[model samples]
Target: MSAATAAAPRPAPASGRQARRGGHPLAGTYPLLRFALRRDRVRLPVWIGALTLTTVGTLSSFTTQYPDAADRRAAAGTMDSPAGLAMTGPGHYLDDYGHGAMMGHQMLGFVLVMVGLMSVLTVTRHTRTEEETGRAELVRAAAVGRHAQLTAALCAAALANAALGLLLAVGLGASGAEGVTWGGSLLYGAAHTAVGLVFAAVAGITAQVSQFSRGASGMALAAIGAAYALRAAGDVGNATLSWLSPIGWAQRTYVYVDDRWWPLLPALALAAAATAAAYRLSTGRDVGAGLRATRPGRPAASRALTQPLGFAVRLHRGTATGFGAGLLLLGVMYGSILGDAAEMVEDIPELRDALREIGGASVTESFASTVMIVLAVVAAVYVVMAALRPQSEETSGRAEPLLATGLSRTRWAGTHLAVAMAGGTALLALSGLGFGAAGAAATGDGGLFLDLLLAPLAYAPALWVTVGVTAVLFGWLPRATAAAWALPVYAFVVGYLGTVLGFPDWTGDLSPFGYVPRLPAEEMRWTPVVALTALAAALVAFGLAGFRRRDLDTK
Candidate 1:
């Protein structure tokens, strides 16, 4: 054919092994698994490394802090207190305080959380998210069977979790703690891996039930959170609650203590049942649809959507309510726990000394200061998410519709930014109020509420700086919004982990949170607050100017 004539006929979509009929539709599973593995290599390794490092770092820190029997006994005594036990699982492992037992008891719950998160994200991304975005459609058009996708995703998560577990085992063994046998380390690692597998199966089932990726992921996360809470309550107050949570099962295995190997089998059995149910559900549901159909919304917008700001308010109302409620609850819980710290100190004199050393003032002030720091960190996260709204709307194509209605770009973007800034401030205030109220109720002291309520405000300037950074990124480096989010992640690493791990002063100083004066512990310095506020304002202005000049990304 002539060149022009040849161009008239479109080429067929490319095809390979997927075009073939096979004994098992999953014959091409290895290739798909390989592709997914390559895609996730960098991100997956970072998560795994970060989690393993958390475990190893805790082990190293504990070794230095409690090198001998007397130190272990003191640490165990402090942990045995109800307040500490409530916060950090049961104290059975702490009861026999060898280095291995001490480290395992203190850090296993944290490790399980990390493993569960990794598994959920991995499974959801590959299964529900892919189907939502229509990638699975293209794959399914091939010789791929329904179960093939789920199988591949499960295999990937299993392999990744298995590798992480092995790495953790090696890292623990290399730490050179006495009584830390290879078998014990492997069992500990397997427990975490099993937890991950169970969650992966849960995510798989959730993906089949929920109509959207967000709903699926949310369901999975809710399950994880509930499991943790149940386990925490049970471990702290009653054994009955522990039986209800998978996390409790893993922790109660008591690595380096009794070293019972039977608990892992339940996790494995749960994973198997969950996986089979997910597969059955997958086969029953149509591609690109869910087991639970989406409910219809009203045909028109609500009366509340009349103005730009009102619309912004409506858009953010759900998140604002959820975040506000969660922060309030957290604050109250922290506040209520504060009263018991003094009693705990009375029981463990070394703990009192430790608190005094780490926290500059009295026990009450020290406990309040620690709680405030945690609240600040969490509040900063809310600020970052709020500030990223403009970027998300623009990239997701929602901003184009608003701009097409003759709204000025600056005004449109500014509306969202305004909500973020104001909403963040309100959230911090609410958090403080919540904690303060809870503290006061618990102790019948009105002054405690005032102190807790004021603490979050002290950290507001630093929180605003993070929001400003996100705004600047949205305006100037729209393509790199992920980098903007990374800024807070880096700050968290330095401010929280750096302090706990004894990182150098300069490293901690790099974080804005580190710069914010610790309130209630030390005298509040106005100088840093003012400087941070000015810096935040300048960043917002710079970002807005850049945003005004840049062309809208209509695509």
Candidate 2:
């Protein structure tokens, strides 16, 4: 052959077995992608709808809060400050009643975080999780290529993210906010889409490295959290550091104001590189194993390992530690910012008024109370994640073998419930302690520490209600266990935006968090706390009873 002909790309000759094995490396991806989409139909719509609603609701609030030119100008002055920039972003759209930019600043971090979460969970669930549960083995036993599963997962995530982006852009543009252009709104939506795609790629790689789905999720989520913090730190201090985080890249798009699109290029490149790495990594491992080998455990069981509750603790401890440490850091951040409460309130009259309605004694106390409540919501999320552990265990085929032993189904379920309750309560308490300690150190009011410490306990009952709901779902609606996540999401929406959206009192009353007294700002009420706790306990009992009556394997 001539040199030019030899240099041209050509297919390698196939051996008999190879010829019989399959077609192209990505031959089955489209079908698999469709299957994944089918599986995620309900899940994706809920995420997209919730995100869109949040965006529109935020827009509505901005319009109502700063309805005039003068109000927008004053809001812009405070938002441009280093403290404000750190909390939100550069306030690029703070001018012109910058409802679009203000919405971007207030909602971008939260929206991107949720998008990242959805992407990571979706990718990991289809890839490592399916493989771990032996579902992928059956798929692979068919005419599937090695890379098809991961490719399909990435494709599905991209589609979901795209849908979410479109929803955001269209929804916000129609929200009737003055001065909010469709172009900026599109960029706002595009930013989250890019962020989600980048994290989907991150999940692809982490799924290859992690031996279990939970670990893969943790790695991916940890990356997202780090990216968010890096950008926040960079925005506040060195602008250069923001470039290092994907979230920074999204925020740098400056959705409504500057509307730059260049930042998305790096995110796209990152996704491509990570997806390529995942494919390469997938080749060296067996169908179900990870690129990293599973470490050998102790040959003998410890005393703690002898019981179901202890086993539950061992399996869940890593995730709880991760959540607790993160919340502690969050507490520190909230505490450090309390000193700026007075200025912040003065600069933003809407917040000042909202705090007053919530019974804020002073700016500082109001801010603290808000932080505690927000932190409680965060804590409740952990509770839901923890409470849903049993479903994960059951789906992975690990529960059947354990149930085959002396363990009864109810006892096995109860152990996990106990862990969920204990772990959730402990995490909330630690978050409270961390918040209090940091606040006390800052303000030097020793009593402030004690007061703030007790604040989180009041929210525990509400969180327990969330946990109870998860358990009930896992018990009865095992196949639909994923829907349990919506409970927390709904609660968060109601708790965070109910007041701002002019929701009726009964609507807010639907959330347990709404029932809990806004501690330190409003006096504590025993009736709601006791009532919620009793309901939680009753739910747990009902869930255990349901689990006992059902088959061990819902599948």
Candidate 3:
């Protein structure tokens, strides 16, 4: 053939592996697995290490705090209540180091949540998100198989969970407490790993069914939340109900008490079933398409949706509604238990002392205040997420189109910021109402409604600080905005372990919540709240200025 008319480069025979791999599926999964690991190298290590450190710190504290037989028995007394059981796990003998095995009792629920979030986000990010961004199609255009992406996501989750399990085992076993045993540590680790895998599978299934990656993530997280709620309700009321939750299954392992390993079987079964379902579902759908179809919207936009601020509200309404509903339920659940708080304090001197140190006045006040504080902390997450919406919009190229028009960058970003701040504040207020209403109804004390409603407001400034911090990161360091999440995560850690781990008061003070009045227990302080509000406003102003100066990245 002449050089100019050379035979076109021959296409590989679309036969054998190339043709059959699509049918077989999972062919390119190994390479995808490597890609997942590389992407998650830092995130996985941070999550595993943080949880392991918490485990070590908690175990070490128990050894020091309950060294004597009498101390152990006294400590065990606090664990007997329905609320305690709901928060921790089934009761266990506290004497002779059995307590060490149940060290996870204080932290495991949160750890499960963390790991579950990790798994759900991982699967959704790799699958639906890739498809949403058109990256999956590009990858599939290569030698990739049909199911490689989903398989890699699940495998990555499994690997991360397994690594987390090993870390927990080593950390717990090395605590050097007289009650700590290697066998219990191993079982404990295995149970947590199993819990993560179960949620990973749940994520995979949701990813297959939900059209939007966001919807997939939401569904998976909702399932996890529902599981936790079921476990809590069951542990506190009916033991049989607990059987329905994967978290309950893990708790039933009784690692330190009986060292049972059977719970792993059910979790493994669930993981296998879910993964199989996902794979089967994958083959039925087209690339980038989901089992569920997006509902049609109005033919014309509403008058309110025409403006930037209205547009922000329209975008934020679903998220706001979700947060409000979840928090309201949570508040009601916590409030329903306040009647027992006083009795609990009377029965357990250790708990009373701890509450007093943290600013609990009466047991009821102390308990209610603590619960409200926790709700406040959770509310901050909504604020941070909302504040970061502009960043998401910008990166996704949605904001670029708006900014390219007459809309100024400040006006566009400000709209989302308003939603984050105002919506978050409103959610907290709703939470307080839910809590107060439920508590009053339960106790037949109508006076409680006012107290509960006003109490959450005390923490609003702290929540605003989180919103400000996230906005600051989004504006000044768009690429590094993810680091903003660490603030709330760290706040949760400090709030949970500060007193238990004997961290310096100043260390806890790093959390904005640390500055908020403990409310109901202590009289509300205005100075700190005002200072926090001023600081938050300043930060937001500074961030907006920075954002205006920077060029938008359309790519």
Candidate 4:
């Protein structure tokens, strides 16, 4: 008929033994979107609450934390260095030194990165993950269209991003902060939405290209990390490099200061373009398969695969490898800045005093202690993700076949937990060494390397406690494996901010990580470490008992 109709997707052909499901390529998209939302109702709310509260708390605290123009201007000096620029955004905002500029320049980078992460996981969880677990095949066997699943996933991500953006806009506009306005706040929220949508589209393409769900997420996440680096370098050295990254696009918007809206257009256009490409690519692949076909396995099974631990390792190796490398590099980045740590806050005594209470230590060492929380919390994330993986296996139906052969549930599940434990420890060790080596080089002190390297190991018991919590959830409340993430998130907020902002001591005592002695800055204490280790062992033992008693989720 018309040009528009010609471009539209057609219904299935009415022929063959199987009757055609007569609808467009997006036939079941709305229903699928509703189902996805239903499944993530609790999860989505938690994400929204965390993001909104963090934004509000940080923005509100800025006024009280830096009450005068002199303080804000002095504070801007901390973000002037290359290391500072790499962590924050462009130096343009530093010129104004207002509360809104401070929030936008500092808050946007971290907020967008997190929003991107949430979007990537949401899409991968619904699309490739569902396909890998065979639920996509089952869903497709009904009246659903080929493009319906991916469409629903992207829609769900969009909804979450929209909600986050709305909350941020409302918070900033109504905050009564000196420089924040409704127009600027609206632009701020739009920037977040634009970045998130772009990442969700990136995840859609990655989901189609990767044969496995983890690979899909890893690819998208690597893209996010690369964007951050590119933007940082561009802001510091080359303006042109920023053009290559979506994050740079969002940052250039300069919300509440320049309040530029033109930069967001690129992000929105890229999101639309990538989504179209993902849909086009999906037409060439079958359900449960990817644009990248799975490689043929060796005809014979490896000796390691015959054992439970090896099988578990093989399943986890891809995710662990990617995440571990990222953590190590993050540690290096944090450590490389140690030489400049004192310079950043030299004019602000309040900021410096909160870093640590160590006697006879330079601010540099205290800075290391404050940042160690971020590194340890990141490692704990891996612990939680890997530890709860057994629940994924059980729900996917793969574990049942193995269990039927000769493996008991406890042995099979324990193998997975062992892998998680070893993998988490290895990740922490690599990060520690990276931090130590980088810090030593930056400061030109050989002695610091050994001390810093040994310091992180002290957190291993705290990490084991994280693994134990996940094990407890997987054992008794298998459906509540997602709850394991609560501890790490809480620990990050309390440990990082409380130490920096001089929060109450009991606030630090609430998390398992709170029990960890601030190494190098504080003398190593064995009492808390031993208690945490014992608690972890007890939790793991109790969890194993629960897992043994509970029925597996075959459906």
Best by lDDT: 4
* Candidate 2 wrongly placed segments (more than 4 Å): 1-21, 80-82, 91-97, 347-349, 441-446
Q: Write down the TM-score of every candidate.
A: 0.86, 0.92, 0.91, 0.94
Encode model 4's per-residue lDDT on 312-405: one tens digit a residue: 9999998899878888888888888887888777776666667646432788788887777888888899889899888888888888888888
| Predicted structure 3, TM vs. truth | 0.91
Candidate 1 structure quality by residue, lDDT tens digits, 295-331: 8878987776767887888666656666687678678
Model 4 / residue 210 / CA error / Å: 1.6
Please, what are the lDDT tens digits per residue for candidate 2 over residues 14-103? 787766557667758889999999988898888888888887888888888887777778777756766567767655556544777777
Worst-scoring 10-residue span by lDDT in model 4 = 15-24
Report the CA-based lDDT of candidate 4 relative to the real structure.
0.87
Superior by lDDT: candidate 3 or candidate 4: 4
Instruction: Output the better candidate (1/2) by lDDT.
Output: 2
Predicted candidate 3 versus true structure: per-residue lDDT over 200-318, tens digit per residue: 99999999898888789889999998888888888788888878989888877767777789977998999899989999999888888899998888999899998999999988887
Candidate 1, which segments miss by more than 4 Å at Cα?
1-32, 313-322, 340-359, 389-396, 438-446, 547-555
Candidate 1 whole-model C-alpha lDDT, 0 to 1 = 0.77
Positional deviation of residue 466's Cα in model 1 after best superposition, in angstroms: 1.8
Clashes of each: 1, 0, 1, 0
lDDT head-to-head 1 vs 3, winner: 3
- The list of candidate 4 runs beyond 4 A from truth reads 1-21, 358-360
Model 3: which ten-residue window has the lowest total lDDT?
92-101
